[model samples]
Target: MDTQQNTALTRALAEVPGPLPARGVIHIVIPHTDRFTVVGNHLAQHPGLSTTAVGFAVRIQSLPQGTEIGVKALAARFPEGEKLIAAALRELEAIGYLQRARTRLPDGRIVTRTVFCNQPSALLRLPKAAPHQPATPQAPAPAPTPRPVPALPFPLQPIPELEPTLQPVQVLTTAPQSVPAPAPKPEPLPPLATTPECAPAPPPQQPAAPRFVPLVPPPTAPKLPPRPLPQPCELTPELHRAATALLADLRRHTPEFTLTEVDIQQLAPAVAAWLEREARPDTIRHVLTNDPPQPLRHPAKLLRHRLTVLLPPPLPGAHDLAVPVRRVTVTPFQTCDGCERAFRSSMPGRCRDCRTDHAQAAA
Candidate 1:
């Protein structure tokens, strides 16, 4: 049945409505072996490469050999802008897929050349060795020798001048006055005798007694232990479990790929952000497992992209509404309660002058 339809279509094409130009058509062939390398090389495994970069690389591969392509031209050809195209070119260069070299021409002008490599092994080729030339014979130069500097035979000594004898000048001194001796203290009076004649003798005074007081120690309060520091939100057990699950899911999709705890740590913030936006683990798992619009050579990058772009809107909650609304009261003028003087204040209260005066009076 398919053969009959093909025969009818061939007969219909034989009767053309218009003439077709043969010179306008051109044909080119891309080898299947190079296609595999472009799609599966170490450059393709880079997590930093976006889908736009991969498309850019594909378009570059489709171009003819030794064709000059500018970033702006490529950007115009593709949907991505010039900035992204330039970034893709940079990524390609970094991953050894592309190389650029600038050469100065004999005309004093500089020109840049782009070298594209499909295979990874081509990037590791050693540079060619320069040709060897015969050496010319020449006399060897004499070695330089150092000459010692002469030292003085004896250390130079400084000369001293002779001392001259001089007559001493007579010095006048004042006579010191002698200090007078202090007078002796008077002798104490004798104690009075207990006699009836002495005002009938005063009643024997009672001996003053010393008061005894008890000492009491003040009570001491017990010391409390210091509070522990709060840990980061990423290091929490729930987030760790979520990150482990995410890595496990990625491994399921690409068994050859492996992620370390450091990667998980880096990705924790994005995961936490998604969770904060009320995204569920199952929903995230579904999004990750579903078929992507384009081929994903780097799962971590794709996961990050999806997590960021597909984040749910924040849900209304009591905590969000509980934020205290700052109330601002505007007043043209106010009077002090104590002094009754007109002043300016947001809320009606005592003026600063009156308050200071009151504080001073209280103090």
Candidate 2:
């Protein structure tokens, strides 16, 4: 009886409809309270927009005004390359979700200004046809027809109630009033005999204050700090030439290191100081050319700093004064006692192969 009851319960459960089983790509959505972007289905599910374009539109619409939405900035934040991001931005622009206009600023700089539209359909909608008006008897003066106002692309907020404007209305009266006679004008008396002493002299006019003008200097490139000068030292013609060549050739390693002729001349003396301290040319080159700042605005200043700061001290002792000499030792060739092969050795001995063979034989 218990088994039958259990079977009946199982049958009833199967017959009852419950929650459907989870399927592919189930989403658990959480309601947002703050710091969220509102995206519309028109953009998210646009048939003409590609996936990248749709995503860009959604992100741009959610962003606050003045936020950077340039292709390079987006590429840096996302995994897509600049080319792909630019293409997506173009697609969004074509679909009316994005607009780019070149605006000239007060400072005389021409920049691209971007405007994002969440509801483009409003602007794209056609103007409604004018309402038909019945022909009435023509009057001498006809009122001008009002033009239709175009729809704004952005959503409109509810307008607050305003106080009604008061208009002046003229009132008419139908009453007869008695008229009064106008008084005659008084006769002008003869000009009083004015003596020069009785009449006051015209007041003297004071001179206007000098106009104050503010002197503003014209805009110019910022002055870079002067390149540091190296300590005074006896510069030789050879060292001077080598230093100049090193400074001039820096452009080969990195174009940013390119310096003007005047810059090279000014910086040459510093490089000469490095040479005077027994610094190798290669070391000097590396110090000056290694990891220069990008978009180098002042190459001379940078080289100057490196030259003065990184200049190595003169070699200790009298070694720096003496000429550097490199000595090489040669090993004499010898015949292997066992294999009769010629091999280089410091002292007469068996070659490596003969030694291994002799050791194996002894073992």
Residue by residue across 207-321, what tens digits does model 1's lDDT show?
Answer: 4432211122213546655333222345567765775677666666655335566766666666666665667777767775577545556666666666666666677899878
Name the lDDT of candidate 1: 0.59
- Candidate 1 matches the true fold with a TM-score of 0.25
TM-scores, all candidates, are: 0.25, 0.30
Among these predicted structures, which one has the highest lDDT?
2
Which residue pairs come into collision in candidate 1? none
Best model per TM-score = 2
lDDT of each: 0.59, 0.72
Question: Once all C-alphas are superposed, what RMSD does model 1 give against the true structure?
Answer: 37.5
lDDT of 2: 0.72
**Cα lDDT of model 2 by residue, 128-164, tens digit:** 4543433322223343442333333554343322222
Reference-based lDDT, residue 180, model 2: 32
Pairs of residues clashing in candidate 2: none
